[model samples]
Target: MTATYAEHSARKRRPLFRRRSAIPGFAVTMGVTITILSLIVLIPLTAVALKAAQQSSSEFLNAAFNERALMAYRLSFGAAFIAATINGVFGLLTAWALVRYEFPLKSLVNGLIDLPFALPTAVAGIALATLYAPNGWIGALVAPAKVAYTPLGVVVALTFIGLPFVVRTLEPVMRDLAADVEEAAASLGASRFDVIARVILPALGPAWLTGFALAFARAVGEYGSVIFIAGNMPYKSEIAPLLIIIELEQYDYAGAATIAVVMLVVSFAMLFVINAVQAWARRLSA
Candidate 1:
């Protein structure tokens, strides 16, 4: 019943992950993480539902479906979706350009993609407002530039804020897809369009959608940036979050909660759909 020196050394040299049982440390770590997330995120979300439930169904419906609330929801969701869609198409191209081909200033272009992340939202809002204003630089170059106090301004603000999400999401995916599959497609006499449509587009679809979803979600919740550009006019250009703030300022806590709950429900539904798509995509890839 004596173990050989080599056998003993081999046992000692085994990787930490190669143990007979999974690490108790991992379970403890995961438990703590899940608990913290629930407390920080899920608990507050539950509180919103509970508070909204305090009102009768009719009251909640009235608050959420009012003229001002309706306008805000339309503008906010509409602008966010538009911005995210634009970002999705252009971000995919940017990701591909950066990953698939090398050109001058590639590193600089990559760094610029993260500029939105580094820039504060309020500052970005102000800067965009100034640039797109009637008399401002970019505005002057293009025709009339009433962009500062318009719904178009809101879309621009959201797009500016959301661009980084799409770019960052697609970048790594593009990097992984480059060269090998492309070369294989090329060697098989596939045209550029054929390779992209067949071998590349399908692969990029899920990640692209995930990025679009992220950008849309970020845009929908945006307050700081959109407020400056959106003009915050009631029944006109105001967004849902801004409208919620208005209700809160007017001491209409129930009203605010009602609108918040609506935003919460819709946002959850959209993000859930996106997540399901992402999961389906991962399954397809696997």
Candidate 2:
């Protein structure tokens, strides 16, 4: 009786959520994670900044802001933005269909969407270049459209690379969403479009923005596939990352770093804005 009473007393003393392990183990995990991140990310980033610091601020600006570099920047950001926008619109529809509809080969279709993730960037670029080039098999048909070796080709390459980010981001969110909300809307005489526009889209706002941000960032850094199709035409098809590589090859490390810093800053700002939009969306949902 006394032992059972003691056991009961112990149970009563335990908190609702007791610690499974009292060992202070996050210290090692934190140290290792931080060290790995610093080595891979912070160290390299710091090196770029340090190399650029070797030059005068005006020199760095002049090198990175020259007409060629500026044109590359324009092409890179412009193509990425257009690609991300396209991904956002179509990815949402794809996610909706996967979650809310059933059809033959649905699983196969889902698998195909992720093929880009497994394919080598070099291989993807080569294939796209061949597919879209003026006189190649598929290109022979489309060359009339003048799609390859032009700015349009860069957008296509970026769009191909960024599609998975959007679809994957929205898929889980759509799956976990309760059918009751839509049901409730329908029950209250709300049309399908109204339910989706007012009830669903608002809930999905943050995740959609997050997906767009990811796609945007990924597209901005893309080089392999774009290089093959872009023709690297100065001021026309060259992208910012390729321009930075050119600067580095020419022994202009400071110029490359300056451009790198600009890309980093702009990407960071974009991600920050996305995060803010997410916060606002959460508040709205609440």
Candidate 3:
């Protein structure tokens, strides 16, 4: 009987919960997780939704989709998309270079990639505004092109803040990608471009998309860094967050909430689509 029982135990799958776990059980862990999530995220979002719901449909639409609001949305989303795309391309190159080669000041450059994350957004905005102002060094060199106090400045700021997201996301994946795969592809008579397209890009697509989505989302909500450079001109360089602040300044709480809800929904929808695409890419790569 003992021999038979031992054989059966060995063949059985391991249970998720061990008889003697060091940590708490599933029920306690799940309860704590849910409670924390509710406190940090769900509760505030629910409040925003409820506040927006106080307004009638017409009022909500008027505040959320006004002409100025629409323009702000366009500028914010457009600049964010452009910046995220730029980051995706250059970030991939940066990651590849960092991983595949060694150069002077490599560590310094790698450390600098995370500067945007550690730097305060307001300080970043101020610094960028100063550097890109018409009389500033870089701005003077550009001559005829204006950067600060323009929509282009918004893109510049967004790109600056978003680059770290893409670079950090790609670096680990790039490092994990074995050189053997590329050599194998080359050995199979594939061209350099073919090796990249066939082996590297396919492996990196999902992660790239995830990084792009994160950058886009971050750029869309960015305020302090953009405002100084953007000049915050109405219907021109103004962003959605600035618009929300404007509404709030006038003590239009419901209107502000309505705009917030619109932004929330749009951001959520875009993220959902990006996540779906990422999932599709993963399946295709698999």
lDDT of 1 by residue, 1-286 (tens): 2568878888889886855655568879899999999999999988888887889889988999978788899999999999999998888888878877889999999899999889888998889878887788887787654787789899989988888899889888877875788899899999999988888878887888889999999999999887877788887789999888888999888888889989999999999998998888877866
Clashing pairs in 1: none
Highest lDDT model number: 3
Clashes of each: 0, 0, 0
Tens-place lDDT digits, model 2, residues 106-189? 999999999889999989999998888888787798657877889999999999999999999998889888999899999999
Estimate every model's Cα lDDT from 0 to 1.
0.87, 0.91, 0.94
Cα RMSD (Å) per model? 4.1, 3.8, 2.6
lDDT for model 3: 0.94
lDDT accuracy of residue 171 in candidate 1 = 80
lDDT of candidate model 2 versus the reference: 0.91
Off by over 4 Å in 2: 1-12, 15-18, 22-24
Can you write out model 3's per-residue Cα lDDT over 151-222, one digit (the tens) per residue? 999999999999989989998998899999999999989999999799999999999999999999999999
- Ordered from best to worst lDDT, the candidate numbers read 3, 2, 1
Candidates in order, TM-scores: namely 0.88, 0.90, 0.94
Question: What does the lDDT read for residue 152 in candidate 3?
Answer: 98
Deviation (Å) of 99 in candidate 3: 0.9
